[model samples]
Target: MTLSEKILARASGRDQVRPGEIVTCKVDLAMMHDSGGPRRVAPYLERLGAKIWDPSKVVIASDHFVPPPDVDSAEILALTRRFAREHEIESFYDMQGICHVVLQEHAHVLPGMFAVGGDSHSPSGGAVGAFMVGIGATEMAGVLVTGEIWVRVPESWLIEWHGQLGEGLAAKDIMLFLCAKLGMSNDYKVMQYAGSAVTALSMMERLVLCNMSAELGAKTGIIAPDAWTLAALREGGHEVGDDALRWQSDAGARYERHLEFDAGALAPQVAAPHSPANSAPVAEHGGVRIDQAYIGACTGAKLSDLHMAASVLKGRKVAKGVRLLIAPASTLTTREAAADGTLATLVEAGAIMLPSGCGACAGYGAGVLADGDVCIASTARNFKGRMGSPGALVYLASPYTVAASAVRGTIGDPRDLLAMKAAA
Candidate 1:
């Protein structure tokens, strides 16, 4: 069996399982954010009689609408808080940024665990080898009540990346390129990332890669635990032992499909408006003027992402007609960026800093684009009306490309800017 199959089999108390088989597995962790928490609360209480399966395994965070856009949103948050308090859940995080980031920073989701969340991007936990899947509110409520979820074992699709990534390229670019190549049709499949290139990525970069599994219509994305994974878990305060490191695919593990890519040949990629798979090389779309540039969200707001943006924006100013927005993924990352002067460098370049939440990515708090405007964003999704008006256009790219475009007021490649800086 594949790594995912092995993990699912263990969670379901089975020695082995095959693809397309249905299994009810014990959930190690259940996450709910403000957007889905309120809705699940009433149904969960009504269905399960106000008794939670386990409070310690439940994580509730206020992220989608951080400051609460209106009374309705505020009440939703209040309801979530009330539920957490009544249940005495110690994992409640209020306005602490994205739930996935909080989970990682607190080491709530560890390797060889089965996790489920209300939001679609819950696969971000797979960065640490956890099988984290996103389900709807109804399913989430059921899991909250019973502490179990029934999932069909997805066929595994192996994506092997060899060689080193080129300058100005990022994990975001690699995913976009893969989305374009794979056509985003992973209905009953899991994306299994491997090879030297994938192993070389940092924990944050791997998180960015797995977080976009939603865009590919995948059940989730996963990387087998390795030495780097162990180090990352320890750094995040998780006391991982040899048992956790034993969750690897068998030698003869089967895969439904396999694809390989040369990471060294990749260029900075950009997805056009309306779809994440509608992508092209960044240099192919240069000079497409942009009105806004944003870098934040679960897929793009890590401290390393901020550092990349800062490196490009340092000693430079955002273009006259452009509005640059920077949002960190978590309070922890925000503090780290501030201490390292990444926040200051971005601010000095005229970037507006927002709270460590979804920000403009979900079209909730700030940096909403107007009709007829074009935006270059480091966010995961670029569907119509994702960032505001349906008439507006949103292009998705890496933080480096977004910051470079912000300085030029157009879709631009970071390599060009970086090369010029090196020459100077």
Candidate 2:
């Protein structure tokens, strides 16, 4: 079996598996956040009529409402702590960072392992070569008791991206591009990315890509194991096993569908309006006009993304009427950016630095938009009312483009800024 097949087999608990077989496997790790964990686990206790089967394998964090924004949130955090203490769950992260980011940094979730979480972005662990899935609360309860899950091997779809993405293009742009091209309503099918472009991206980039598959309604997105992936795992303190380091797609590997993407020809894309799939080329749209610009989230909070935002805002202020909110991915990332003066650069440009948490992106705390407001953001998901009032509009773009737009207070293209800056 290929690596993908092997992973599916292991997760499904089958001795030998072929494509298209349905099976059930025990979950190696289970994670939850404050918002969902309390609700999910509370009901589980009620349903199970007993304590959790094992607490060590379960990890819970309150990153969503970290620094709890309201009285209600504080109560939720209090309950989460109570439950964690009672369950003796070995791993519990406070509201210090994004759940997905902390999962890799402190939790050491690994590849060839099956992990499930209440949050849709749990597949972020796939970057470390794990077969991760995101499910609802009830599903999580079952895992909490049995430590096992049932899965149907999804029919795979191969998406090949070739050539170099032109200047100012980033992984987020590719996701917006695909989301629009594929149509959100019909993209729930399984999606996998490969080809030269996939090999060219860094681990963070791959994570950014797979992270957004949920926006397209995919079961979970994954990239075949490779050396870059292995090195990234090592950096995160996950030891790679010989058999665990694997790849998929044998000769004549069957795919439900095959789509080719030309990275070079693809311009930076923006998912306009309320839906991420309603995309248009940055230039073609003239400018969607934004009252606020955001440069942080699980998708764009990495060190490289910070560097990109800082460079664009280095000597310029955020344009009149536009506000940019920047949040680092983790406490470690915050420290690294501050030490390198990247955080200073962002603040110097008039961008507001929030705590190292999900914050506004998930609409749990600050940064909510008012009715009729327009925002250009780098976070995942642009579904209607995702950020705040449904009347508000959001356009999804790359970090560079987001920075550039903040500098201009409109939907400006980053390539144009780069060209003008180079000439100056």
Candidate 3:
């Protein structure tokens, strides 16, 4: 069986399980944020009639609308807070960060665990080899009542990536490239990343790789736990045992499909307006002007992402008409960036730093674009009207590409900036 299959089988108390089988499994962690928690609270009470099944296993984060853009959003957050307090949920995080990043930083997700969240991108936890999946409000309420939920085991696709990534390219570019090639048809199937290139990615990079699997219409994305994954787990304060490293795909595991790529020859990629699969190399869209350059969201606001953006904007300023917005993924990341002067350098380069939350990515808090405006953003998803106005256009790219475009006032390539920096 695949690693996801093995983890789900173990959680369901089965020796073995196969694709297309329905199984009820005990949930290791269940999470919800402001966007879904308020609506779920009433259903949970209606279904369970008072007490939650497990408070320790539940995580509630006040993200999506951190400061509450309006009175309605504020009321929603207040109700969510009330629910957490009434249930005595110890993992409640108020204005801490995005829910996924908060869980990652808090060390709640572990290898071989079956986790679920209310958001579609909840699969981000799969970076640590956890069998994480997203559920609807009704399903989440069921989990809140019984600590168990039924899931259909998904077939697995082996996506092996080898060779070193080129300079100025990132995991986001690779995902975009794959999305363009594969065209998002993997319903009820998992994308299992492997090979040397994948293993060489940092934990945060791996998280980016898995987080975007939602764009591909996948059940989830996962990687086998390895020495690097163990090191990251340790660094995040998780105590790793020998058994944790045993979570790997079997030698003769069956997969529905297999694909391979050489990362060394890939170029930085961008997704055009309205579709993640509508992608092209950065150089192909050069000279396209943008009004805003945004860097934030669960997918794009990690410290490494910020560092990459900072590298490009170090001694430069955002173009005269371009507004660069930087939102860190979490408060912890915000503190780290501030302490390390990443925030300062970005600010010195004329970038506006906002509180760590979903920010403009959700089209609520900050940097909303007007009609006819064009934005080059590092945030995931570029669907129509994702930012604010339906007439506005959004282009998704890596942090390096976004930063370079911010400086040049157009969709620019990071390698061009790198070459100029080197020549200087």
Candidate 4:
């Protein structure tokens, strides 16, 4: 059985589970954010006179509307705190970071666990081998009332990437290439990543691959736990179990589809406005000017991601007319970046740093683009009007590309900047 099948089987008290089978599984963890947490679930729980099935098994974060830009947003945050305090949920992370990044920072997720999150990017948990997926507000409330939820076992699709990634490219580039090649029609299937390139990636990069699985329309994305995965959890202060590495797909595991790619041959990619499926090589979209270059969101604003941006922006400045905004994924990410001088490099490049939250990624809080604005961003999604005015055009790319674009004031390749810096 695949890792997902094995975990689901254990959670459901079964010997095995097959693709297309429906089963009720006990949840090992449930995660929620301010936007979708207490405010969304409190009313249903009150109506049913129910309490959280297991507060200890839950983790909540106030990521969205973090700085509370208005009264309505502030009230939402207040309700989130009240709900956690009233329920005695000690695992609540308030304004600490995006829920997904916060959980990884604190090691709340582990291999072989069955987890669910209230946000669409929940599959980010799968980077560490958890069988995690996203659910709606009603479905999340149901999980809160009862720790068991039903799921349809999905067939796995293996996307094996080999060779080595070229400089100035990253996991975000790999995922953008996939979104265009595979198109986002993979419903009821799991997008499983494997091979040398994926295994060589750091946990932060692996998180990017799984976090964007939602863009592929897959049920979730996951990677089997390896020494790298276990080590990351351990470094994050988790007392990883001895058998944590055992959570992997069996040899010759069945997969509905197996696709292979040569990572070394791939170039940096960028997705055009309205769809990640409009991706192409960076050269294809070159010379298109941008008003803003944003590096933020759970998918793009991690510490490592910030380092990538800093590398390109080191001795450069943002284009005279372009606004460069950097929003670290978490407060912890900000502190680490600052300590290492990455934050200074970015600021010296004329980048404006924003609070660490899900800012401007969902058209919430600050950094929203104005009408007819054209921006290059490092966030995962680029749906029309999702980041601001429907008239604004948002292009999605990696931190390297976004930073390079900021320096050029246009959608240019990061390799240009990297190569020039190397020569310098």
Candidate 5:
């Protein structure tokens, strides 16, 4: 069994595990954001006399609402800052990108490890071949005190895709297409990706796929660690010392289920009104009306995504009835965009620039939608009230599609816009 398999088995509390048995596993690393960090760590400190077992294994990022987006957020950051100072924690990524992105960018996650965070997308680390899970505040508190958390080792589902991804399609589309095919009911199952397509994607792209697997209700999604993953880690400042970067299934790896997608046939995907799982080919719903388009989030805030957006929006303006909000995933991403002139291109195309952070995806402060408004976004979830009034509709699409819709004022494919731009 792999590390993921071992952790899931132990976490599930099964005894005498074999090739097919389930068990519960101990968490290796734990993370929390400012919003939940104070509350979660407070309990743990109270129980353990304010002395954490290991500050190195615990990480706290002030991302949920740092720099005080509001009074409430200000208070949260203060308390979180106090906690970090008191613990002498060394692994903190303060004033950085969104927690998931920051973790990956800083190389805080490693293969064959187990991690849990207060945020839903902790599974983002699973892209690096770790067993990552998300927990509620109380559960996180327990982890802080005990330095360990348990989880049910879910049965694995093998998902394989092959061939090169076409233009305008991204790793995010792969997730949407799978969730739509697997159905929402499959949530909480472990999803493992393999085959040629998995190998073809970059580490950042793979992270986008696994990070959003939560929308499918998946326990976690992971890819076998490979050279591409190792290269990413090295670039992110990790020195692996040449340990094999291979994470392959056992010769007879057992999975409770299976799925297959043909990479060659997959078009850029769109998740229509309200559900990430309600997906279709972009063309199937390309003409649907839209009022707003967002081209940034933790999932879609990469430089490549921004470059893709800029390419589509260059020399073009957002449609009259549509509002486009362009937020980089982090201050660092924003800086990179500015340095590369992508920010200028986006602004020139009539996109409104906003400070980096969770932004509208967090749903409280910025870019809140009104009743009956329709938005196409790159955020993780489109649940009711996720970004404002429950009645506002959010369609999840890749940054490419979001950029296209910004120009068209409707759901449009990026390839179409690229062709149009070239012709113009």
Candidate 6:
């Protein structure tokens, strides 16, 4: 069986399972944010008068709509707080970070666990070798009450990214390249990344691949547990032990498809407005002017991601007309970046640091584009009205490309800037 199949089989108390088989699995954890947590599921839980099956297994964060800008937003946060207290949810992370980042930062999700989140990027947990997926508010309410949910086993796709990634490239570029090659309509499919380039990536970089799997329309994404995965888990205070390595895909694991790519030949990629599938080489989009350059969201503003942007922006200034807004993935990221001077580099280069939250990525918190604005962001999606007015254009790129483009005030390749910096 594949790693995903093995996880499902274990979670469901089955010896083994096949693709398309429906199985009822006990959820190891359920995560939610202010936008989709208590406010949306509370009424339903009340209607049924059901208590959470296990409060300790639940994690909540106030990310979207945090630091409320309006009365309604404030009330939602209030309700989120009230619900957390009422249920004695000890894992609630309010205004500290996005739901996905907060959960993993606290090591709430572990390898071989079957987890579900209210946010689509829940698959980010798979970076740690967990089988995690997103469910809607209604379904999440059920998980909260019963601690169990049904899932149809999904076919696995093995994407092997071999060789070495070029300078200024990252896991985001690899994902955008895949988004174009594999259009975002993959239902009931799991994207499991592997090979030299993928395994060589930092855990945060690996998380980017899994986090963006949702953009491919995949059910979830995963990577086999390795020394790096175990080390990261241990650093986060999880003693998964050597036994967690058993969660890997078997030698003869069954996968519906196995695709391979040469990381050396890959270029920085950018996705055009309204669709991540519109991705192409950064060189193809050169000279497309942008009004704003944003680095935020769980996918893009992690500590490593901030360092990526700072590497490009150091000693350089953002274009005069461009607004560079950065909201670190979490407050913890902000502190880490600040300690290492990455935050200073960004602010010195004209970045305006917004509070750590979903921010413009969710079209909430701050930095939402105005009508007619053109922006390049490090967030996962560029769908219409996702970051602001429908009339605004949002291009998606990596932190390297976004920071380089911010300096250029147009879509430009980060490699060019890096090369120049090296020569200087």
Error of 4 at 107 (Å): 0.7
Estimate, for each residue in 50-151, the C-alpha lDDT of model 1 and write its tens digit. 577998899999998778878987888888888788888899999988998888888888888999989899999998899999988878878878899898
lDDT of each: 0.89, 0.79, 0.90, 0.94, 0.79, 0.94
Scored against the true structure, residue 195 in model 5 reaches a CA lDDT of: 78
TM-score of each: 0.98, 0.94, 0.98, 0.99, 0.93, 0.99
Residue 181 alpha-carbon offset, candidate 3, angstroms: 0.8
Expressed as tens digits, the lDDT of each residue in 130-194 for candidate 2 is: 76788888888888888788777766678889998887888888889888888765333557788
For candidate 1, what is the TM-score? 0.98
For residues 1-424, could you state the per-residue lDDT of candidate 6 as single tens digits? Answer: 9999999999999999999999999999999999988999999999999999999899999999878999999999999999999999998898998888887788888889999999999999999889999999999999999999999999999999999999999999999999999999998899999999999999889899999999999999999889988888888888778988888898999899999999999999999988999999999999999999999999999998999998899989999999999999999999999899999999999999999899989898799988899999999999999998999999999999999999999999999888888989
Which TM-score value belongs to model 2? 0.94
Q: What is the lDDT of residue 220 in candidate 4?
A: 95
lDDT of 5 by residue, 236-335 (tens): 8999755635445566777887777788888888888778888898888978899889876678877767888898888899999899997777777788
Give candidate 6 regions above 4 Å deviation. Answer: none
Clash number by candidate, in order: 0, 1, 0, 0, 17, 0
- Model 4 misplaced regions, further than 4 Å: none
Total backbone clashes of candidate 5, pairs 3 or more residues apart or in separate chains: 17
Candidate 2 ranges beyond 4 A from true positions = 15-20, 186-188
Q: Cα deviation of 247 in candidate 6 (Å)?
A: 0.7
Better of 3 and 4 by lDDT: 4
